[model samples]
Target: MQLIIMRHGEAGRHSLDHERELTEVGRKQAANVAEKIAQSDSKPSVIWCSPYIRARQTAAIVGDILGVPVKEKSFITPDDDPGRCLDALLENKESPLMLVSHMPLVGSLTTLLSDGHRNGMPFMTAQAVVLDMPVVGPDCATLKTQFLP
Candidate 1:
Protein backbone atom coordinates (compact mmCIF):
# COMPACT_ATOMS: atom_id res chain seq x y z
CA MET A 1 0.00 0.00 0.00
CA GLN A 2 1.13 3.52 -0.71
CA LEU A 3 0.11 6.19 1.76
CA ILE A 4 0.33 9.85 0.93
CA ILE A 5 0.01 11.96 4.03
CA MET A 6 -0.64 15.61 3.27
CA ARG A 7 -1.07 18.66 5.43
CA HIS A 8 -3.89 20.94 4.37
CA GLY A 9 -3.01 24.23 2.70
CA GLU A 10 -2.64 27.40 4.67
CA ALA A 11 -5.93 28.59 6.18
CA GLY A 12 -7.26 31.91 7.27
CA ARG A 13 -8.41 32.37 10.83
CA HIS A 14 -12.06 31.64 11.55
CA SER A 15 -14.23 31.94 14.63
CA LEU A 16 -14.67 28.19 14.54
CA ASP A 17 -11.60 26.09 13.93
CA HIS A 18 -13.52 23.63 11.81
CA GLU A 19 -14.77 26.38 9.57
CA ARG A 20 -11.42 27.82 8.67
CA GLU A 21 -11.02 28.23 4.91
CA LEU A 22 -7.94 28.16 2.73
CA THR A 23 -6.40 31.42 1.65
CA GLU A 24 -5.63 32.36 -1.96
CA VAL A 25 -2.04 31.26 -1.54
CA GLY A 26 -3.31 28.05 -0.06
CA ARG A 27 -5.33 27.27 -3.17
CA LYS A 28 -2.28 27.81 -5.34
CA GLN A 29 -0.21 25.62 -3.09
CA ALA A 30 -2.73 22.83 -3.28
CA ALA A 31 -2.85 23.03 -7.03
CA ASN A 32 0.91 23.01 -7.28
CA VAL A 33 1.19 19.91 -5.12
CA ALA A 34 -1.56 18.23 -7.08
CA GLU A 35 0.30 18.94 -10.31
CA LYS A 36 3.42 17.39 -8.86
CA ILE A 37 1.52 14.29 -7.83
CA ALA A 38 -0.17 14.02 -11.20
CA GLN A 39 3.21 14.06 -12.89
CA SER A 40 4.64 11.39 -10.63
CA ASP A 41 3.82 7.71 -10.26
CA SER A 42 2.50 8.37 -6.77
CA LYS A 43 -0.85 9.78 -7.77
CA PRO A 44 -3.48 8.49 -5.36
CA SER A 45 -6.46 6.40 -6.32
CA VAL A 46 -8.59 7.89 -3.57
CA ILE A 47 -8.41 10.72 -1.08
CA TRP A 48 -9.54 10.69 2.54
CA CYS A 49 -9.55 13.98 4.36
CA SER A 50 -10.61 15.67 7.56
CA PRO A 51 -14.09 17.14 7.51
CA TYR A 52 -12.71 20.56 8.27
CA ILE A 53 -13.18 23.16 5.53
CA ARG A 54 -9.52 23.63 4.67
CA ALA A 55 -8.78 19.94 4.54
CA ARG A 56 -11.85 19.28 2.44
CA GLN A 57 -10.78 21.97 0.03
CA THR A 58 -7.28 20.60 -0.25
CA ALA A 59 -8.56 17.10 -0.89
CA ALA A 60 -10.98 18.38 -3.48
CA ILE A 61 -8.18 20.05 -5.42
CA VAL A 62 -6.07 16.92 -5.48
CA GLY A 63 -9.02 14.70 -6.29
CA ASP A 64 -10.00 16.90 -9.18
CA ILE A 65 -6.52 16.86 -10.61
CA LEU A 66 -6.13 13.12 -10.24
CA GLY A 67 -9.72 12.39 -11.30
CA VAL A 68 -10.20 10.42 -8.09
CA PRO A 69 -12.92 10.62 -5.46
CA VAL A 70 -12.63 12.28 -2.10
CA LYS A 71 -14.22 11.13 1.13
CA GLU A 72 -14.60 13.15 4.28
CA LYS A 73 -13.32 11.36 7.36
CA SER A 74 -14.21 12.73 10.76
CA PHE A 75 -11.36 11.07 12.62
CA ILE A 76 -8.54 12.92 10.86
CA THR A 77 -8.96 16.24 12.55
CA PRO A 78 -5.96 18.13 13.97
CA ASP A 79 -6.27 16.85 17.51
CA ASP A 80 -7.55 13.36 16.72
CA ASP A 81 -5.53 10.46 18.07
CA PRO A 82 -3.11 9.01 15.51
CA GLY A 83 -3.59 5.41 16.64
CA ARG A 84 -7.35 5.72 16.44
CA CYS A 85 -7.06 7.37 13.05
CA LEU A 86 -4.86 4.52 11.85
CA ASP A 87 -7.49 2.07 13.07
CA ALA A 88 -10.10 3.93 11.08
CA LEU A 89 -7.87 3.89 7.98
CA LEU A 90 -7.51 0.13 8.27
CA GLU A 91 -11.22 -0.26 7.63
CA ASN A 92 -10.74 0.88 4.05
CA LYS A 93 -8.99 -1.38 1.57
CA GLU A 94 -7.67 1.10 -0.90
CA SER A 95 -4.20 1.33 -2.38
CA PRO A 96 -2.40 4.58 -3.07
CA LEU A 97 -4.52 6.34 -0.49
CA MET A 98 -4.17 10.04 0.09
CA LEU A 99 -5.11 11.67 3.37
CA VAL A 100 -5.49 15.43 3.75
CA SER A 101 -5.50 16.82 7.27
CA HIS A 102 -4.05 19.41 9.64
CA MET A 103 -0.67 19.90 11.20
CA PRO A 104 -0.43 17.79 14.31
CA LEU A 105 -2.45 14.85 13.08
CA VAL A 106 -0.79 14.66 9.67
CA GLY A 107 2.61 14.82 11.28
CA SER A 108 1.85 12.38 14.06
CA LEU A 109 0.09 9.94 11.78
CA THR A 110 3.01 9.93 9.33
CA THR A 111 5.43 9.15 12.14
CA LEU A 112 3.14 6.50 13.58
CA LEU A 113 2.81 4.77 10.25
CA SER A 114 6.51 5.00 9.38
CA ASP A 115 8.21 4.81 12.77
CA GLY A 116 5.81 2.99 15.08
CA HIS A 117 5.70 6.03 17.34
CA ARG A 118 3.76 9.25 17.63
CA ASN A 119 6.84 11.33 18.22
CA GLY A 120 5.45 13.08 15.15
CA MET A 121 7.13 14.45 12.06
CA PRO A 122 6.75 18.09 11.08
CA PHE A 123 5.00 19.35 7.97
CA MET A 124 4.57 22.67 6.28
CA THR A 125 1.25 23.66 4.83
CA ALA A 126 0.58 21.89 1.53
CA GLN A 127 3.45 19.46 2.03
CA ALA A 128 3.07 15.73 1.52
CA VAL A 129 4.96 12.67 2.68
CA VAL A 130 4.84 9.46 0.67
CA LEU A 131 5.13 6.10 2.38
CA ASP A 132 5.28 2.54 1.16
CA MET A 133 3.70 0.01 3.47
CA PRO A 134 3.26 -3.72 3.12
CA VAL A 135 0.50 -3.50 5.69
CA VAL A 136 -1.23 -0.62 7.34
CA GLY A 137 0.32 -0.73 10.80
CA PRO A 138 2.89 0.83 13.03
CA ASP A 139 6.46 0.47 11.71
CA CYS A 140 5.11 -1.11 8.56
CA ALA A 141 5.66 1.85 6.30
CA THR A 142 8.83 3.22 4.75
CA LEU A 143 9.21 6.92 4.09
CA LYS A 144 9.63 7.28 0.37
CA THR A 145 9.90 10.98 -0.33
CA GLN A 146 8.16 14.28 0.23
CA PHE A 147 6.48 16.76 -2.10
CA LEU A 148 6.80 20.37 -1.13
CA PRO A 149 4.70 23.17 -2.62
Candidate 2:
Protein backbone atom coordinates (compact mmCIF):
# COMPACT_ATOMS: atom_id res chain seq x y z
CA MET A 1 0.00 0.00 0.00
CA GLN A 2 1.11 3.53 -0.68
CA LEU A 3 0.23 6.24 1.78
CA ILE A 4 0.55 9.94 1.25
CA ILE A 5 0.61 12.12 4.33
CA MET A 6 0.15 15.84 3.95
CA ARG A 7 -0.02 18.70 6.42
CA HIS A 8 -2.62 21.29 5.73
CA GLY A 9 -1.60 24.72 4.47
CA GLU A 10 -0.95 27.72 6.72
CA ALA A 11 -3.97 28.93 8.63
CA GLY A 12 -4.83 32.16 10.40
CA ARG A 13 -5.11 32.36 14.17
CA HIS A 14 -8.60 32.39 15.60
CA SER A 15 -10.32 31.93 18.92
CA LEU A 16 -11.83 28.72 17.61
CA ASP A 17 -9.00 26.62 16.34
CA HIS A 18 -11.08 24.06 14.52
CA GLU A 19 -13.01 26.70 12.65
CA ARG A 20 -10.05 28.75 11.59
CA GLU A 21 -9.88 28.97 7.83
CA LEU A 22 -6.84 29.10 5.61
CA THR A 23 -5.34 32.45 4.73
CA GLU A 24 -4.68 33.71 1.20
CA VAL A 25 -1.20 32.29 1.30
CA GLY A 26 -2.61 29.06 2.58
CA ARG A 27 -4.96 28.79 -0.35
CA LYS A 28 -2.09 29.35 -2.74
CA GLN A 29 -0.05 26.75 -0.98
CA ALA A 30 -2.86 24.24 -1.23
CA ALA A 31 -3.30 24.97 -4.90
CA ASN A 32 0.39 24.56 -5.55
CA VAL A 33 0.47 21.22 -3.81
CA ALA A 34 -2.65 20.05 -5.59
CA GLU A 35 -1.13 20.97 -8.91
CA LYS A 36 1.97 19.01 -8.06
CA ILE A 37 -0.09 15.96 -7.13
CA ALA A 38 -2.15 16.22 -10.28
CA GLN A 39 0.99 16.06 -12.35
CA SER A 40 2.43 13.12 -10.46
CA ASP A 41 1.95 9.57 -11.70
CA SER A 42 1.01 8.26 -8.28
CA LYS A 43 -2.52 9.51 -8.00
CA PRO A 44 -4.47 8.79 -4.87
CA SER A 45 -7.39 6.38 -4.99
CA VAL A 46 -9.12 8.26 -2.19
CA ILE A 47 -8.40 11.13 0.16
CA TRP A 48 -8.98 11.13 3.89
CA CYS A 49 -8.99 14.55 5.54
CA SER A 50 -9.48 16.01 8.94
CA PRO A 51 -12.69 17.88 9.57
CA TYR A 52 -10.81 21.00 10.51
CA ILE A 53 -11.55 23.90 8.19
CA ARG A 54 -8.04 24.31 6.89
CA ALA A 55 -7.61 20.63 6.22
CA ARG A 56 -11.00 20.33 4.62
CA GLN A 57 -10.20 23.22 2.31
CA THR A 58 -6.87 21.72 1.40
CA ALA A 59 -8.48 18.36 0.69
CA ALA A 60 -11.08 20.03 -1.50
CA ILE A 61 -8.43 21.54 -3.69
CA VAL A 62 -6.48 18.33 -3.99
CA GLY A 63 -9.60 16.28 -4.60
CA ASP A 64 -10.66 18.61 -7.37
CA ILE A 65 -7.30 18.43 -9.05
CA LEU A 66 -7.00 14.68 -8.75
CA GLY A 67 -10.68 13.98 -9.35
CA VAL A 68 -10.83 11.85 -6.22
CA PRO A 69 -13.39 11.76 -3.44
CA VAL A 70 -12.48 13.07 -0.01
CA LYS A 71 -13.78 11.59 3.19
CA GLU A 72 -13.69 13.40 6.52
CA LYS A 73 -12.11 11.25 9.19
CA SER A 74 -12.09 12.47 12.75
CA PHE A 75 -9.20 10.19 13.62
CA ILE A 76 -6.81 12.39 11.67
CA THR A 77 -7.33 15.42 13.88
CA PRO A 78 -4.32 17.12 15.38
CA ASP A 79 -4.87 15.66 18.83
CA ASP A 80 -5.94 12.17 17.73
CA ASP A 81 -3.89 9.06 18.24
CA PRO A 82 -1.64 8.00 15.39
CA GLY A 83 -2.15 4.34 16.20
CA ARG A 84 -5.87 4.59 15.86
CA CYS A 85 -5.48 6.37 12.56
CA LEU A 86 -3.22 3.64 11.35
CA ASP A 87 -5.68 0.97 12.38
CA ALA A 88 -8.44 2.70 10.51
CA LEU A 89 -6.34 3.04 7.40
CA LEU A 90 -5.32 -0.58 7.59
CA GLU A 91 -8.94 -1.59 7.38
CA ASN A 92 -9.20 0.07 4.00
CA LYS A 93 -8.05 -1.78 0.91
CA GLU A 94 -7.32 1.25 -1.20
CA SER A 95 -3.83 1.97 -2.41
CA PRO A 96 -2.25 5.36 -2.85
CA LEU A 97 -4.31 6.87 -0.08
CA MET A 98 -3.87 10.55 0.72
CA LEU A 99 -4.48 12.06 4.11
CA VAL A 100 -4.77 15.80 4.57
CA SER A 101 -4.43 16.68 8.22
CA HIS A 102 -2.77 18.93 10.82
CA MET A 103 0.55 19.48 12.52
CA PRO A 104 1.53 17.17 15.34
CA LEU A 105 -0.61 14.36 14.00
CA VAL A 106 0.94 14.55 10.56
CA GLY A 107 4.47 14.56 11.90
CA SER A 108 3.71 11.91 14.47
CA LEU A 109 2.00 9.60 12.00
CA THR A 110 4.83 9.92 9.51
CA THR A 111 7.41 8.98 12.10
CA LEU A 112 5.33 6.16 13.49
CA LEU A 113 4.79 4.70 10.06
CA SER A 114 8.28 5.17 8.66
CA ASP A 115 10.60 4.84 11.64
CA GLY A 116 8.49 3.12 14.33
CA HIS A 117 9.00 6.13 16.59
CA ARG A 118 7.14 9.29 17.27
CA ASN A 119 8.77 12.69 16.69
CA GLY A 120 11.36 11.29 14.31
CA MET A 121 10.17 13.63 11.58
CA PRO A 122 9.04 17.22 11.41
CA PHE A 123 6.40 18.24 8.92
CA MET A 124 5.94 21.78 7.70
CA THR A 125 2.63 23.18 6.64
CA ALA A 126 1.71 21.99 3.14
CA GLN A 127 4.48 19.44 3.24
CA ALA A 128 3.79 15.89 2.05
CA VAL A 129 5.55 12.56 2.37
CA VAL A 130 4.94 9.31 0.56
CA LEU A 131 5.46 5.89 2.10
CA ASP A 132 5.47 2.39 0.66
CA MET A 133 4.20 -0.11 3.18
CA PRO A 134 3.76 -3.85 2.87
CA VAL A 135 1.57 -3.83 5.93
CA VAL A 136 0.24 -1.33 8.42
CA GLY A 137 2.50 -1.32 11.44
CA PRO A 138 5.22 0.64 13.10
CA ASP A 139 8.36 0.94 10.98
CA CYS A 140 6.88 -1.17 8.19
CA ALA A 141 7.04 1.52 5.58
CA THR A 142 9.82 2.95 3.47
CA LEU A 143 9.98 6.67 2.77
CA LYS A 144 9.55 7.13 -0.93
CA THR A 145 10.12 10.89 -1.09
CA GLN A 146 8.44 14.14 -0.13
CA PHE A 147 6.59 17.03 -1.73
CA LEU A 148 6.91 20.63 -0.59
CA PRO A 149 4.75 23.50 -1.72
How would you encode candidate 2's per-residue C-alpha lDDT over 10-80 as one tens digit per residue?
89997498998988888888888888877886689999999999999999988988899999998899899
Clashing pairs in 1: none
Model 1, runs deviating above 4 Å: none
lDDT of 2 at 88: 93
After the best TM-score superposition of candidate 1, give how far the Cα of residue 35 lies from its true spot, in angstroms: 0.3
Tens digits of lDDT, candidate 1, 39-149: 999988899999999999999998998899999988899999998888876887888999999989988999899888998888999999899988889999999989999
Q: Model 2 misses residue 51 by how many Å? A: 0.8
TM-score of 1: 0.97
Clash total of candidate 1:
0
Quote the lDDT for 62 in model 1: 88
Q: What TM-score would each prediction reach against the true structure?
A: 0.97, 0.96
